[model samples]
Structures are given as C-alpha cells and as structure tokens.
Target chain A: MVKTYVFGHKSPDSDSITSSLVMTNLEKELGNTEVQAYRLGNINKETEFILNYLDIDAPELLENIEDDANVILVDHNSPSESVENLENANILKVVDHHKLALKTSYPLFLRFEPVGCTETILCKLYEENNVEITKEMATLMLSAIISDTLLLKSPTTTEDDKKAVTKLSKIAEIDVEEYGLKMLKAGTDLSSFSIEEILALDAKQIDFKNVKSIVNQVNTASIPDVLEMKDELEEGMNKIIEKENLDLFMLLITDIVNSNSQVIALGKNADLVEKSYDIKLEDNMVLLEGVVSRKKQVVPIMTENA
Target chain B: MVKTYVFGHKSPDSDSITSSLVMTNLEKELGNTEVQAYRLGNINKETEFILNYLDIDAPELLENIEDDANVILVDHNSPSESVENLENANILKVVDHHKLALKTSYPLFLRFEPVGCTETILCKLYEENNVEITKEMATLMLSAIISDTLLLKSPTTTEDDKKAVTKLSKIAEIDVEEYGLKMLKAGTDLSSFSIEEILALDAKQIDFKNVKSIVNQVNTASIPDVLEMKDELEEGMNKIIEKENLDLFMLLITDIVNSNSQVIALGKNADLVEKSYDIKLEDNMVLLEGVVSRKKQVVPIMTENA
Candidate 1:
C-alpha cells in the first residue's frame, strides 16, 4: 500500500493541523487508510491545547518536503512545485489558501479553495464524509478558524469562516465569540519567547542569485510590547547574523500599538535599504506608517521598491 | 484601462521572457488592450538572443515578487491563490502551469491549463480565441516551450512541447536545437564579475538573539570551475564576513559534475561538515557523493545538520 503523508505550510497553525487530522480520518472513512498527517512546521501552544484537549496524537514535525514521503501540502506553497520534492513519492492531494504555483505533478484529486482556513474546507469534507464530527475534531477546527480569520477581522475572511464558526460552535459545544476570544488570547503570547524566536517563526528566505538571506517580521497585538522587545529582537538578529554570517540582516517590528512597522536593515549595503524603501532612516528605523499586515502591507512596499 | 503586467520567474531564462511577451499579444487579441509584459528576473543570454531575433523590447527586470507590483505572476506562485492578489484588480485572465491554490472569492472567468511553459498554455489560448499568432509571438512561445521543457528531456515535458516546437519552428524560421545549444553556451559564461559582486545578489539577514551576521552563497554551473573559482569564492566570503565582523561563516563550492554536488561548507562547523555528509574532506572540499540540485540536494541537508 502506498502510504500518504499530509502536511501544512512552514510553521503551521491550528487550522492546518486540525484540518489534516480531521481530513485524515475522513479519508480513512473514504477507504484510504494509508494517509498519515504531518506538520511541515512547528505547532504553537493554542493548537497544542485543542489537540491535547481532544486527545489527538500530535502529528510529526517535518521541515521540508524533500523528506521521504508521499506528501499532501497545505497552506503556503501555492501551486505545489515549492513542496513537491520527494522524488519517489506521489502527491495524492493538496488543500491550501495561497495561490498555486505551476504544478509539479497533477494530483489524483486536488481541492483548493481560498478561504481563511483549511479547517473550514475540511469541515465540509467531514460533513460530506458523514464522519460524525467528534467534539475534539470540532474544537480543533473551531480554534483553527478563529486564529486564521483573526476573529473574522482579516481581509481574507469569507462567509465560509462565519459559517464554520456557527457550525463548529454547535458541534464543539461552545459559544463562538467566547471561544474565538479565548483562542486569540492564547495565540497572542508575545512574551513567551524573546524577539529573536518570534522573528524566526515568521521568517522567509529571499534568494537573489549569489546572495541569500532571510527577512523576518513580527505582527503584534500591542506595538508598545513589541517596542519593549525591540532590544531583544535586535540582539537576537545581531547574534544570528554573526552566527550565519549573513550578507544582510533585518527585522520588521510592527507596533500593534501604533499600527506601523519600524524597519531596520543591516549589511554593507544596509544603506541600500533606505534607497529601496524611499524613506530616510529616523533613529535607526524606517518608519512605515499604516503598515500592520506583514504580507499585504509590508511585503508590497518592499516588492514595489525592489 | 486596467493594465495587466505580465512576467516570469527570477534568474530568468528563455521561457520566462518569451511566454510573457507572447501572452501579452494573446491578451491583446482577446481584446484586452492594456496588457504589459515585464521580466521578474534578469534576462539570461538565451532569452536575450531569442528577443533580439524577434526584435522585441525585453521586459524590465524585476529581482523579486515578494512585494513588487501588483505583478501579474505567470506560472509562479500557488495556483489557488493566483487571483487572490488580483482581488483589487478586474482580473482579465490567468495563465500558468504550477498547482492551484484555493480562491473562493467568486468565480474564475479566464484560466489556462497547466503545462511546461506559460507560452504553451498561451498557444492553446490563442487557438481557442481564434486569433492570429504573430511571428514574434510564435518564436517566444516556442523558445519558452523549449527552454522550460529542456528541449523535451525533462520529466515535465509533454506532447504540448513537441506540438509547440513544430508550430514555432515554422514561424520563427530557425532550427531550435542549434539555437538552444548556442543559448546554453552563452548561459555558461561562468562569471565575469568578482565573487564579492556575485555574493551580493541574495544576501540574507541572520539573528541569533544578541549576535548578528550575514550569510551568502555563490551558485555555479560546474564544480571544477567553482573549485577553480575557490580562491575567488573564499576570498569574497571571507572579506564580506570579516568586513561585516561575522562570528561564523560557510561557503559551499558545489560541483555540478554528472548531476552530483560537492559542498565546501566552511566556517566554525566546517570541521563537522564531513560528519554530516559522510564525506572525507579532500583538500578543503566536503565532497558530497551523488548530491546534485542545490535547491533539492544541499539546502535541506544543511538546514537539518547545521
């Protein structure tokens, strides 16, 4: 039997893990017992809670798709080439929110719908498969829906998220607003780790021919707190830079307080960043006003300038 | 008019440029008059020759799409989220080969099937639209098909590539094999610039809590040549590391001989690299047996063992 491995984007959250788990059970119901779910990235505390509360075995952690497995990727890699690295395995399916890349190989079946969370799509599958939505699966999906949609505040939110909340609340035996608030509260633990750890969690690698470096940002609910962590963030960045001997170093500290990001770029051409952003450095930070969203707001300006 | 900017992947080749240009014309015939084509990466020699032969203006070079334009990413990004970015735009259409991402915002009006090149998909679109395929467009689409499919030797090759080649050869009036060889020759110009200049392309930032350093890599087509360039690569890495005062450093001199890569991971862990790859250090090179494809073979191992 060809075993199937399920995974989500790098640094997966509640929705990815829960949906894959629910979907794996749903797949078994559909007569595919070889599918096993895995996490492409590390799991956070809140997702851990929902999984533990329901007593679901936490999926194994995998760093890259290059590992040996027939993988089903979710969340981050758009089309699949980014995640289709295993040479000998087959990619049976994919479920994600990001745009797809040019394909590596077409799936036996693929379901990609741009919604706030993967769990919403999987919930529908769970319902379709009539795999009696267990309380644990419901809670997992519920927490996932909450974190990804940002309590339905993100621009990416859709009617499906609202629907998922309603359906999941009933199934999981919880109040929607109260659960959402609690999950968000649990997810927003900024002080649990130093600025460096927070930065690495959301870090992305930027490859330019000969030069390659990672850029990381931290989106905070409280910018004042982010400021407080600034010293640690800087210290962490400096240490990593020294350890890795990077060509350039940077961190985008978005003050949840001011709803803006203070960008600090370091390198020989660190000055080039000033030219790239069309902003003058003020007290060691590029003051980007109204830059709250890491992907929509900050990345756009960087791309436009690059 | 909402102008559509078309482009291809960075570190571009023949496929990236031509496909975008041809697609530009195809969109025009489809009555989308505001289609603008651009190159997301540098125009490689192969593409330069193809464009010069067709007497077309090469698209402007773009280093990254991380935040650039509102770029109309073709055959890049996850397919499901392809049009998510097009949320604000009145998306005229999408052409790609990568896997699809989920987008449930509404409905998709125009989408092409996944294939080897964006140009291959464009050919189908042109035929379906019952429009004229210009000589310039034909050359571009053909070159794109040829380059992306690696002259039909790659696993991704399809019958569409052969069909595109036949049609394109009649229009472009050139023997593609000879042209492809010449383009490949031009591509292997090795390096005309210093290793320092080359390393600046994709330099990244690293943070280890309190310390900071920059990391860089120099990718080459040949291993012996990379080794020949060893002095150059090393001097460059050292100068940058020292000038930047980096605490640790490593340079990989990968040999792309017979689809195998030998890495020279120098720095503090340089001593232990031999243990990671099970390679005996032979004169400053950590010889990795049967290791090829830097993106696939090397990075994952390093991230794990490092």
Candidate 2:
C-alpha cells in the first residue's frame, strides 16, 4: 500500500493537529488507504488537551517536508509553503485557509475567507460529507474553531465560520457560549508562567526598516496579575529588543469583555506611538478600545507603520 | 484574538484538509475560540474532484513555516522533530501515529498502532465520543479509509479499519463492498495520468550509502499495462535520479489479480537481482507471485543488496 502522510505546518496548534487526524480518519472511512499523520512544529499544551480528551495521540512532527519522500502536507496549503519538499513530484493537493501565496495552482481547493481558523474549512467538509462527529472530535474541533475564530468574535470571522460553528455546535452537542468560557479558562492559566511563556502564549512579530520587532498579548481575566508581571515582561522585552536591535516593542493589554486595550512600550522612543496608532501617550501609556485581538489589531498597526 | 493559524502539512489532500477543518470546527463548538486552517501543499485533481463534488471550494494554502515567529506544530508527537523556526517555545504539542520523537511530554496520547490511516483514530474518537457520523462526512471518511486501506484488500487493512468502515458504511447509507469499489475507481483514474504521475502517486524514497533512491510502483489488474509503462517510468525516473542526484531508481508492477510482480530496476546495476527472492530475471525483469505491495515486497529486494 502506498503511504499517505497527513501533516500540518511547523508550530502547529490544536487545530492543525486535530484537523489532520480528523481528515485522515475521514479519508480512511472513504478509501481505507494509508494516511500517516505528521506534525511540522511543536504541539502545544492546549492541542494536547484536546487530543488527549479525544483519545487520539498527536502525529510525529516533521520539521521540513524536504526530507519526506512522499508528503501530503496539511495546515499549510501551498506548494511554496511546503518548503518545496518532495520536488520529485509536483504538489498533489492543498487545503488551507490563509491568503493564497503568490505561487499556487489552479483546480485547487483554495479557500480564503479571511476567517481566523483553517479548521472552519475542515468543519464544512465534515458537515458536507455527513461524517458524524465523535464527541471527542467534536470537542477537539470545537476548541480549534473557537481558538481560531476567537469565539466567532474576530474581524476575520465570516458567514461560513458562523455557519460551520452553528452546525458543529449541534453535532458536537456543545453549548457554544459555555464552551468558549471553558476553553478560555483552560488557556488563561498564567499564574505560574514565565514572562517568555506569557508573551509567547500567542506571540507575533513584525519587521520594519530592516529592523524586526515582536509583540504579543496574553489573554487573561486576571488583569492585575498580568499587570504585576508587566515589569518582568518589560525587562525581557528590553533584553530581546537590545539583542535583536529592534526599533520598538510593546505588549498590548486587551480586555476581551470590554475590547479595551492598554499598550506598554519597552523601547527608548516611547513618543513614537503616533507611528502605529491614532493615539496619544499619557505618561508613556496608550489606551484604546475594541483592540482585544492582537492579530486583528496589532498586526494591522505594525503593517501600517511598517 | 491572537490570530491562531491551524494548518496541516503542505500539499494536503482531502484527508488533511478535511480533518483540519472538522477538528477546528469541533474546537469552536467546544470552546468557542478562534482558529484558522492552512495547508502547506497544493491541491490535486483527485481531491479537487471530491471537494467540487460536494460544492465546497478548496482551502487557501499557507506559506512556508520557515522562520515563523511562532510554531503551533502537531502530528509528530515530539518537540525534537519540530523544525527550528521559532526561536522560543520550540515544542507546542506532539500528535502522531509514529513513535514519539525523542523528548515529549509524559501526559501525551501516543498512538503507535500500525494502522493504515489516522482517520481510524478519528473514527474511534467519534465512536467513543458518540458523535453521530453525518452521511456526507461518512462518505468522505469512508473514502479516506478506503484510500488508506486500499479497499480493505491490502495487507495493511487492519481490523480497526474494517470496523470503522463497517460502522461508517451504515451511516454513509451505502453498501461496503459496492462503495469501496466505486471509491477506488474514483481515486485511481489512471487513464489520463502519465507514468511519471503513476510513479509519483504514492512513491517514497529510500536512502542508502548517503544517497537517496526513489521507488515507484503501480498496481494494476493486467501486466500488459505495467509493461507498457515500464519504459516511460524508467526514462522519467532516470532523469529524476540524475537531477535529484539520487543513487538508484526502481519501479514495481504489482499485478493484483495475478498476485505477482514484475519488478523493474534502474541505475548502474539495473540488471542485478536479489538471490534470496528466487527472482527469475528474464532480462531486467524480476518475476514473482503473491507480491502485491512495493513496501513489503520490492523495497525489501531493492534494499537487500544495498
């Protein structure tokens, strides 16, 4: 039997891992062919939680497809993104939800909804194919969709995601509202986390003027505790900025409830706030509303200034 | 919402793409969080056929995860194999069927079963979780299972795959044997495909002497077609071997009906045959019987001499 490997991109999270398994299983039900589940990057704790909850293990993480002879790459949906691995044959299939890269193929499944999660696409397939969601898989998919869609609260959320979520909620037999709170509670356990982890919980980076900078916001309800860790975050940010020689750095505090934000800068030029957003600094602090999501808010600001 | 991108490896076929989407949707249902799906590879015509059949567009392929600021890796159940992209948090979660790569968390769900597809695991999750299989999803899952298990005829066909197929068949509203045949017919439409494509369809590389060698095989009902494609495959593989700087090349003809094979070879020692297999080499052909699998049959012979 020919081996078909199912894998996600590097640094895959719950969605990629669970999606690969789900799709692999779905295809298996269809054809009974060989599909190997693989991972590109590390599987975080949240992903593990869902996997363990679902009673499925994670796939072996492959760093690059360059080494694999025959790769059925998941997560990333482009040939270019596959690191051009398996140059032996052209890419056979691609299923993803990000903007299509500059280089792509025709007759592809190229879904681009500007939604946050690739898993939404998987949900639609499950619904359309009429595959019953196992309670565990339902839980897993539910977490992935919510995590990617930000509980359908992200600007990237679309009608499709909304529809997918609605259908998935029914099949999984989950209260979408309560499930959101549970996942958030599970995700926001930051009391004992280090500053590095806190920033990296959902971190991001930007490159401007040939200088690279990184900013991340940890989602948490315990604002005072996060604020207490602010000093450590500043210190860590300072060191990282110096070593990397970044022009600016800041951690935006986003309140999910109020959608309000407070920016904490760690750069020498604190007055350069005008470069990123339309706001003024009061005592080197910037307050903004409806700025809870880092991807929706921070990335745009960074790109605009960049 | 820190934009979380959930994706599978590149060139994801129907399995990877569908699973990622389904799992993401489940997550959203369970946690009401945000998630995105991505693929690293391009979409193939076969998968496109299935997706288009359901009136669903393919997903957007993701760019390479190289040098990605953060990696949410999955599949491979180890941080060690995570491609060194993000400087920090190298490992997030490990989800895989292969053995855990070196160091991983202890509380991981490591599934090391020698199964044909990861969808089997997903099927189990659905069963255990009591998630009802939808007709559409059951069809897709059935296709995937059939693809992985080779219509429940291949040696890799596990009892688990059979059980999943049986259960899914009921939900899919189809007869198992009939549906299996139809799905296979749909999957292996080799009429318009080239020998190069047939060779690349489910080909894998074997490395020996610090040099990589590729093995391609095609299983057909008749030997004539295999013989017809022999020259094309040889020529194509020869160029691939030279350009890729591989050590050796070989392709096998597995006549499923005859339960035999006509193994073909390339490279400097193309005429040589392994003595142990009782290969009756009439010219360059290594004739045999009950040898329908390349991985189990031809690969052993090719690597025996290496």
Candidate 3:
C-alpha cells in the first residue's frame, strides 16, 4: 500500500489546515495513492470554528515523520515552518502560496502561486482537474481565503484570491460581510491562551547570516487589548529566547480593523526592528501605522536589516 | 526588454553547458521572454569539441547575477551547484535531472526528472512545447547525454535517457559508437591540465552533518595511467581541503572502459570511505570493483557513512 501524508507548516492556521485536507481530497479523487491529511500543531480557533461548522473531523496531529516517509506539503515549503526532519522526507508533491525554501534530492510535483492562500491555488487545480467542489470543501476554502487575506484587506491579497473568495462564497452560500467578520473575531479571543501559548500560536523562525530569530503575529480587532498583556508577553518571549538561544524574538499584534500593528521586540538583535523601521524601540514597544502583512511588510524589512 | 539568464552549476560539465543552450532555445521557441544561455564556468574539452563540431558558439560566462534577476537553471538546483548569489535571484524556472535542492521566494515553473542527464528532460520539454529541435541542437544534447550516462552504460542511466539518445541520434544523424568514443577520448586527455586544474574539473561539494566534503571525478580509459600522478593529486587535494575548510576531499579516477574506479581519499574524514565500503585504505587509495556512477554509487554510500 502506498501511504502518503499530506500536511502544512507548524503553528497551524486556517489556510494550512484547510489546504492539507483539500489537497488530500483532490489526490484521492485522482485515484493514485492513499493520502492521509495531517496537521503539524493544534488547529487555531478560527479553523476549529470552520471545521465544526462543516462537521468535518480535524486531521491527525503529526509530530515527527520518518526519514523516507512519502509526504505532500501544503501551504508552506520553508524548512523553518515545516515539520522536524522535513529535509529527510521524500516529498512527493507540494501546493503552496508562500515563498519556496525547500530543497529535495529528487524532483517532485510542485504547484505554487503568489496568492494570499494555498486554497486559492487548490481551487484552480480543482477546476483544471474537473473535480467538483463540495459545499463543505467550498466553505472551508472560502474561510481560509478570508483568514489569510484578512477579508481582502492585506497586501498579500491578489486578484486570484478575490476570484476564489467570490466563487467559493457563492458555492458555500456564506455572506462575506457576516461570516468573515465572525470568523476573524473568533480567532481574536485570547482569554483561554496563556502568554506562552500566545507566543507560539503563529510563530515562524528565520535564520539570518549570523543570527537566529523567531517572529510571531496575531491578528486582533483591537491591538491595544493585546498590548495590555505586553509585560507578560515579554516575559514569555524572554524565556523562549533563552530556551532556543535565539538572537531576537518579535511579536506583532496587528489590528485588523485599523490595519496597524503594535510590536513587542526582545532579545539581543531586537534593535534590528528599530533599525529596519527607523523608529525608537522604547521599552521594546513601537506602534507602526498601516503595517499588516507579515510576509509582505515585516519579513522583507527584517531580512534586509538582518 | 525582459532578460533572463539560463545557466547550470559551477565547474561546468558537458551536460551543464549543453542543456543550458538547449533550454534557452526551447524557451524562446515557445515565445516566452528573451532568454540567453550562459555557462557558469569555462566549457570542458568534450563540450568544446561538440560545439566546434556543430559550429555553435559557447554561451557567455556568468559569475554572478543581480538579486531578482530572472534565471532558468538547468542540470542543477542546489545552491552549491548554481551561480554565486543564487539565493538572491528570482528563479523563473528550472529544468534539471538532479536531486531538488532549491528554494525560491515565489512560484515558478519547474520541469525535473530523475534521469542520468538533464538533456534527457529537456528533450521531452522540447517535444511537449512543440518546438522543432534543430540538427546542431540535437548533437549538443546527444553529446551531453552520452557524457553524463557514459554512452548509456553508467548505473545512473534510465530508460528515459536511452529513449532520448535513440531519438536524438536520429535527429543529429550520427553513428553513436564512433562519435561517442571520439568524444569520450577527447575529454580523457589531461596532458595540458595542471594538478589544480584536474582537481577542479567536475568537482562537487557535499555538506554532510558535522563535515563538509568535496568529491571530484575524472574519467579515463586506464586507471593506472591516472594513478601515476597520485602524489601530485593528493598534494592538490590537501591544498583544497585547507582552502575550503573541508573535512573530506575525494578524487575518483574512474576507468570508463572497465566501469571501475580507483579513489584517492584525503582530508580528516578519509576513513569514511573505508567505513562505508568495508575496505582498508592503503595510502588513502582503494580500487572499487564497479563504481562508475557517482550519483548512484558514491554519494549515497558516503552520505550514509558520514
């Protein structure tokens, strides 16, 4: 039996979880192999809401895969964001929207589009393959598009994503104004998450020439609400910096409504953010107006500075 | 005007040089952007002979490319094999037969096959794109395949390569045995090359955990004839080990006619060859019964041992 595990990057977002399931279904519909959907971490609240709404069971949690396990990656190709021991796995296929940072010994199928979400690319694949999108799949895909594009407000949003959202919303019969806001608000609830959990919720590690750093982002309706917990977040970030021996740790608390961000930077290389944005990082805090997308705005600036 | 540079890895081989030209031709015929073929290094003797035979000009040499300069890679994908500053370039497409060891920031077209030669994959692409393969183009591509697969005798040779050879030979209108022997003989002439030049010819760097190594292979009809220069070769290898800070440096004097290899293992991890192949290294030399294909035989075993 040919078994292939399909998964996305760690710190599972809605796009990552939904795209894995969508890709597995499409692979099965093609009738080549036995593909199983998997998640690298606990599903976020927004993703949980979508899954519960569709009544689809969450994928199995995968901590580690074997060296030669046949796998298909979705949503991400960065080794930093992928599962541990990803370099050793036999990657069979990849469907992603992010920058490619993966290298394999052998060639495999890869379909990447510079869109907001992996599900947008999957939507095109589904159409090209003549696979019908079910109501539940449509709902989940639409949710992912909205989550990633921030209801088409993010810099990463593209014409392809807008097209996918419009078509998928019709199929899923969801009001864009009603369901998108509800879903985004669902993910903003930080009451249950500890400071540690919050730091790791959507964290990504990046390696610079001489420094290693972790950058985490959380979207909220009110960025000041998250800032109220800044002291606790800094404490948690410092503990993580010590544990991972990181050069820098950054937390970007983004306001979806205002399209601004409040950053809490810590660690030795925390000055990088200050230099990148030309702002004084007083008490490791800075408010940047009109900055939202991590991939478009934050990473490029930090990478240039680093 | 849109400009794209097409090239292969450093220490360029016949396949690397020829495939770049062939891919450029194919891309242009398909009516894409303006694509220019380039060589990462000077063309080898065998490639020069083939280019002269067809009266085709060798591609311009490229040392480095600007960040986001569009590039289409051939024969290789590893940053180690590609142009300097490859990580910064915007990779538009890749046509390779080697293991996938590339990561890009955005999605691009990639046509990769696990065949013995990159030209074998390019042959299919030309057909798929409905582009006419000229006579001179056919000769260069066939020369590349013969060089890489050793006239379809190397272990790395696949059915796809054999099929490509048969079809390409028809297009080029050449007697395979006569031309293949002449081409192979031309590359075996090391009379003018210094020890340093010989070591740099077709060398590949491999980074294993806790060790960095360089593997260089030279094909000859008589292994003993090449071994006569073993002392000079070892001295050169030691110099390279120090220069590159490598833990291991290996030189394979492959007897092409007999399909066997004599290895000159040097550096700190020279014992790895002994451990991997269950052989005792006398004066850091060992004769392997049949080890013509470095991709199929040497890399995997050495990687396992390392």
Candidate 4:
C-alpha cells in the first residue's frame, strides 16, 4: 500500500493541524485507507490543547517527505509553506483556504474557496459526501474554526463559517461560546516559549512580486507582555533575515482580546510596511489598530506594496 | 461590468475551443452577465467543422490579456499553455481537465479532474448546476469528446466520457456512429495546410523532469499521406527547435482509420525517445504500431525516459 501523507503548512496552527486530521479521516471514509495525517512543525499550544481535550494523540511529525510522495495539502497552497522537496512530490489533492501559489506539472484535485478556515471547507465536503462526522472529529473542526476566525470576531469570518460552526457545535454537543473562549485562551499561553520559539510559532514565508518576505504572528491577551521582549524578538528576526536571505520580516504581536496588533518590521524592504499602513515606525515598531489576520490583513497589503 | 476573458490552452483543439464556449454559456446561465469566451490560438479544422455544423461563431482571438484582468481558464492549467500575461491576471475561476500547474497569490475557485476531455467535466457541471444544455451546445460538447478520445478508441477514454457521449448525442439528436466518423474524417483534412501550419496545429511544450520538449500531432486517413510531406515537416521541426531552443521535438503522424502512428523525432533529447521504445531511428523516423493518444502513450513514456 502506498502511504499517502496529509499535512498542512510548516508552522502548524490549529486550522492547519486539525484540518489535516479531518481530511485524513474523510479520505479514509471515502475508501482511501492508506491516507494518514502528519504535521510539518511542532504542535502549537492551542492545537495541543484541542488534541488533549479530545483524548486524541497529535499526529506524528514529518521532517521531510521523499521524492514523488503522494500527499494531500490542507490550509495552504503556498510552496514556501509546504514541506521540503515539494517540487518532486506527486501532490494528489489540495484543499486550501489561503492564496493559490502552488504549481504542479500534472493535474490533480483542487478545492480552494475564500472561506475563513480550511475546516469550514471540510465541513461542506463531508456534508456533500454524506460521510458521518464523529464527535471527536466535529470537536476538532469546531476548534479550528474558532481559532481561525478569532471566535467569529475577525473580518475574515464568512457566513459559511458561521453556519459550519453552528452545525458542528450541535454534533459535538458543546456550547460554542463557552468552548470557543476556552480554546482561544488556551492558545494565548506563550509564557514558556523563548523569543526564538515565539518568532517561529506561526511564521510563513511569502514570495510576492519577486520579493522574499516572512510574516510571523503570535497571539496574546496582553500586548505589553509581548512588547516587553522587543529587543530579544528583534535580534531573533535579524538572525532569521540573514540566515534565510529574506528581503523583509514583519512580526505581529497581536492582542487577541483587543483585536489589534503591534508589528516589528526589519530588513531592507521594511519601508514597505510603512508605505502599506501610512504609519511612521518608531524604533521599527508600530501599533496598527484593528489588525489581526495575516491572510486577510497583512498579506494583501504587503503584497501590494512589494 | 467587468469582462472575464475565458479561454483554453495554446494550440487549440476541439475540446479546448468547445469547452470554452460551453463554460461561457454556463457562466451566463449562472447569472454572471459580463462573462465572455475567447480562444488563445487559431481554431483547428476539426473544431471549425463542429462550430460550422452547429452554426455557432467561433470566439474572438486573444493574443495577450491585460494585467489583473478577470479570467476563467478551461481545458488547461499549466502556465506554459495559458495566456501571455496570466501571471498578472486575477484568475476568477478555473475549470479544467488537465494537470494543475497554475499558481496564484490569492484564493480562487478551481475545478480540475483527470478526465478524457474538458467537455466531459462541463457536461456533468451543467447537469449538477441544473442549467439547461441547448442542442447546439450538446453537439459542440459531443464533438469534442469524440475528437479527444478518437471516438472512444484512444486509451485516454474513460467510462465518464462514454456516458457523456451517449447522453450528449441524444440531446444533439444525432447518431453517434454517423457524426463521430464524419467529425474524425473532417479533422484529417490537412491537404490545404502548409507544413508550418500543420506542425503548429496541436503542439504542446512539456517541461518533464526539467527537460524542455515539444510534442505535435496531426491526424490522417493514410499514414503515407502525411509521410509524403516528411521532408517539409522535418524542415519545419528544425526551425522550431532553433527558434524555441527546444531540447526535443516529436511529431506523431497518426492514421485515424488504422489507429497507428509514424513518428519523426529530432533534437538533442531524441535519444530518450529511441531508448523509451527501444527502437533505433532510421533517418529519425519510426513506425509505432497501435499508438494513437499522446496524452496517454507518448508523454508518459517520453517523460519517464527523460
């Protein structure tokens, strides 16, 4: 049997990790018994919380995939966020909610929508195929939706996402507001992680208009708690910029409760962040009011400027 | 109103042209009033026959698209086969039945399947969306399936294609046997075309294992009818090899009636083809018995060796 590995982006967030699990389960239900879920990075706090809550073990780590390994990608289609040696892999299918930056030589199945979360698309696919969503799976998907949409507060939330959360919450037999707040709070626990770890928590490399850039975001309840480590964070970002030969690096210290973000910009293309937001950078940092999503807010603006 | 330019790949064939028209009509039915169909290259004799039979005018030609133009692609997704400014276009949706090789910075709708013809997928799309398929459209789609699959004789044909032909022929109110043979014979009319035009009729550039190669095919009733023009055709192929800086070029002079092909191979990578079939080239020409479809037989074999 050819073992088909399913994974998400490199920095595995809740949506990326959970959607992989959901897709692997759905593929098995569709009679592809060799499909297995894997994670490209270490499990984040929120994803670990969800797995522990449901009594489900985290998927095994996949450091790198072999050439021509059959795989399914969820939550991302950007080649930079994909596993190493992706150019040689035989991508069987792609179920992503982000931008489409993936190119393959041969045809495969692709389901890309402008939804807030990959789980929302998976919810519709399950209903369309009439596959039974178990309670554990429902909880996993519901947690992903809440995390991606920030408890339905982020502007990226769609009517489809709202609908999926309502339907999935019923199947999971959990109060959405109660469970959602707990899940979001669980993700905000970043006290133990070092500055280097925080910078790598949710970083994604984006190549836009021939510009190589990296955008990293970390959620916190108190913005000041993250800003206090600004010097250390800047050092980490500079090390990454030199090592990756990046043109720009922007780290979003997002306040989850306030729905605002304080950004640290560095590298040669740092002026692009200033031009994108029309704000002056004080010591390479600026507080942008009402900014949260990297997909909805950060990427589009930075891509336009780049 | 924003006009969405819809088109297929370069070297337009029956399926590539007809599928664009069908997709345009389906989009208009779905209430997108600004959608219009276009073609990337000149229509082949076989596609022109189908359009004339249905009394439908061929779509206008498009050389290059404006930056950020709204576009919908049919029949192909490879960047090489797409429009000139496709990298700058805002792709609204893609409905293709070929390998996926497109990359976009933002999310869009993509429907790709590994079917025999793009029209087969469109036939199912129309039925699923509950849009009425007019008789002319049915005939156009039916003609495309028969052309691509060589009246269901090619190895690329699937059960879906057979079913699509059976159902579409009914709506077209024509006997499949009678019209299919006529359509196939109509495409074999290469007497009027120059050697250069014949070589450009249905050629595709494939990047396999990073090797740049070109594959061109032309159908004929008798293999000798095409082989008679071998000197001129070889001259044309040599010109293309120098102009395009190609590594290899293979032209399949396929006999539609006998289901066999005489191949002319040239360029630095010509040895790959000789090794693939284990046949020595006699003046760079060889007879491949029972080889018809390029997508199924030639490409896979040459790509493996390359």
Winner by TM-score:
4
Model 4: lDDT of residue A56: 90
DockQ for all candidate structures vs. native:
0.06, 0.02, 0.33, 0.60
Candidate 1 vs candidate 4, TM-score winner: 4
Model 4 chain A weakest 10-residue run by lDDT: A99-108
Where model 4 places Cα greater than 4 Å from the true spot, the runs are: A173-175, A208-211, B132-135, B166-174, B208-212
lDDT of 2 by residue, A97-215 (tens): 54233231111122223455666766755665677767666676778888766688766667877887777788788898786766665666666567766665544454433446666
Which candidate order results from sorting by TM-score in descending order?
4, 3, 1, 2
lDDT (Cα, tens digit) per residue for candidate 4, span B1-306: 899999999989998899889999999999998988999888888988898898889999998988989999999888889899888899988888676677777777777767789999899888867899889999989999999899899888889899999999989998988888898889999977888889999999986576788999998888887788889889999999999999889999888888988999998988887888999999999999989989888877877887
What are the lDDT scores of the predictions, listed in order?
0.60, 0.58, 0.87, 0.88
Ranking by DockQ: 4, 3, 1, 2
Q: Say what the interface RMSD of candidate 3 is.
A: 3.1
lDDT tens readout by residue for model 4, A36-87: 9999988889998899999898888999989889999999887788899998
Q: For each candidate, how many residue pairs have backbone atoms clashing (under 3 Å)?
A: 74, 157, 2, 3
After TM-score superposition, the amount by which residue A145's alpha carbon in candidate 1 deviates from its true location, in angstroms, is 3.0
Q: Flag clash pairs in model 4.
A: A106-B99, A107-B99, A107-B100
Regions of model 2 farther than 4 Å from truth: A1-5, A9-11, A30-32, A40-45, A64-68, A72-92, A101-109, A128-132, A208-211, A243-245, A267-273, A281-285, B1-306
- TM-score quality measure for candidate 2: 0.46
Residue B9 accuracy (lDDT) in model 2: 39
Worst 10 residues of 2 chain A by lDDT: A102-111
